[model samples]
Target: SSRYGEDLGKQDALGNLIRELARTDGIEWVRVMYTYPTHISDSFLDAIAAEPKAVNYLDMPLQHASQNVLKLMKRGGNRKSLERLIERVRERVPGIAVRTTFITGFPGETEEDFQELMSFIKNVEFDRVGVFTYSDEEGTPAYELPNKVPHRTAARRRTALMKEQSRISKRRNRKRIGEVVRVLFEGESKESELLWQGRMETQAPDIDGCVLINDVPEELLPAEGDFVNVEITEAHEYDLIGRIVLV
Candidate 1:
C-alpha cells in the first residue's frame, strides 16, 4: 500500500492500520512505499520484521545523495544518515529489498554533485532504483532557486543513472536463480497467452519486476491471486522466468 506525499511510518495511526492489515490471514502480501528517510522509526521496522505477511520491501525516495543538493532540496537527511538507515533496515529485516528513487540535475547541482550521487548508488547497491530529471514546477521552492540545470543536461543525467541501475538490477535478479519463491499469480503474460505472469514477495505489483510462469500443468494452474511456489530458472534485467513447482 502507498501513502503518497505522506510518510506512513511517522503516523502511528496509519502505521498501526497497515500492521493490522499485514497480520490478516487473507492478505497474502503487504508492501509499503514512499516512506521518508528521516521518519522511518524503529517501531515501523520492528513490525515489518515481525509480520509474516508483510513483504520485505520498501520504497524510500531519496531525491539526491550529495549533501549540497540534499540541503538545497531540504530533504532532511545527509548521505551518511541515509546509508546508516539503509544498513539498519537490512540488519533488522534479512533479505529485505530496498527500493529508492533519485533526482538528477537539480538547481545548483554541480558535476561533482552528480558524481557523488552516482557513487552513493554504487555504494548502496539498492535492490531497485529509479532516477528522474528535475522539472521546474512553478510556485515551488526549487523553481526560484538559482543555477537551474539545462533540460538537456538533466535528461542526460537521468539516462546515465537509469543505465547504471539497469546493470545493478540485472546482477541482483541473477542471484535469485535456483531459488524457490512463492509467487502471487496476476494473470496471463502480456507477451503470450500460453504463459502466465506473477510476482514474488520481493516484487511489488506494477512498479517492480515479475516472474513469468511457464510449463504449468493444466490441472495445477493457479487462479489469479493464488500463491504458488515457483522455481526460478532464468533471470533477466527486470524479470524472472520460472515454472510452477507442484508439491
Candidate 2:
C-alpha cells in the first residue's frame, strides 16, 4: 500500500519486517513490493543489502516524471529529484533491480511534459518499466480538471514511452547474460511442455520476467518448487534462456 511505513512514526518498519521474516525457517526470499519513493530510507536499503535472504529488488512506481503533470495529479516529484533518488538507491544497494511504472497524458500534460518524461526514461536505465495511459474516474479531482488530454493523445504517449522502454528493458536483461544465478523452478512452461520455466531472484513470481529453461541434464532434474542454479546463456526483451547448472 502507498501508506507503507506511515504508521510507527514513519520509521523503517518495512526494513525491520524484512529482517524479522528472514529469520523464519522456510522463508527463503523476502521481496518487497509497491514501496513509495517518498519513504525509501537508507536503513531500508541497508537491510536489503545486508540480508542474504532479502532479494535485491525494489518496486517503486513513479507515476509520472513531469513536475507540472505530477502536481496536477497530486503526485509531486520532478525528473531531477527522482534521478538523485535512484542514484542514491543504487549506491546503497549494489546489483539491485529497480522496477517502476508511469502514467502518460495526465490532465494538463503538455507536449513538453511528455518530452520531459521521455528524457527521464532515457536518463535512468531502470531494470524494468511499465506505462499506462491516464483514465478519469468519477468523483475524482482529475475527472473535473481543466485541459484534460484526449484519449488518442494519451494512448500515443503511452505507446511511445513503452517503445522506448522496450529498448532499455532489453538492454537491462542483456546485462544478465553469462551470470550464474539461482532460480525457483516452476515446472513446464506455458509456451511449451518441453521447455521449463523458473524465476530468478530479480524477477517476481508474476509481476516480472522469468527464466526459460531450454536444456537439462538427463540424469539430474529439478522438481517443481526446487531451487536450482542456472547458467544464463541468452537474454531477450522479457525473458531469459538458461540451462540448469547444478547436479
Q: Pick the candidate with the highest TM-score.
A: 2
Which 10 residues in a row give candidate 1 its minimum summed lDDT? 1-10
TM-score of 2: 0.96
Off by over 4 Å in 2: 1-5
Runs of candidate 1 exceeding 4 Å displacement: 1-15
Question: How far off is residue 178 in model 2, in Å?
Answer: 1.4
* Cα distance off (Å), candidate 1, residue 228: 0.6
Q: List the residue pairs that clash in candidate 2.
A: none
* lDDT value, residue 198 of candidate 1: 92
lDDT of 2 at 137: 92
The prediction achieving the highest lDDT against the true structure is 2
lDDT at 7, model 1: 55
Worst-scoring 10-residue span by lDDT in model 2: 1-10
Q: Write one digit per residue (lDDT tens) for candidate 2, span 84-189.
A: 9999999999999999999987889999999999999999988888898989999989989989889999999999988898888888888889988999999999
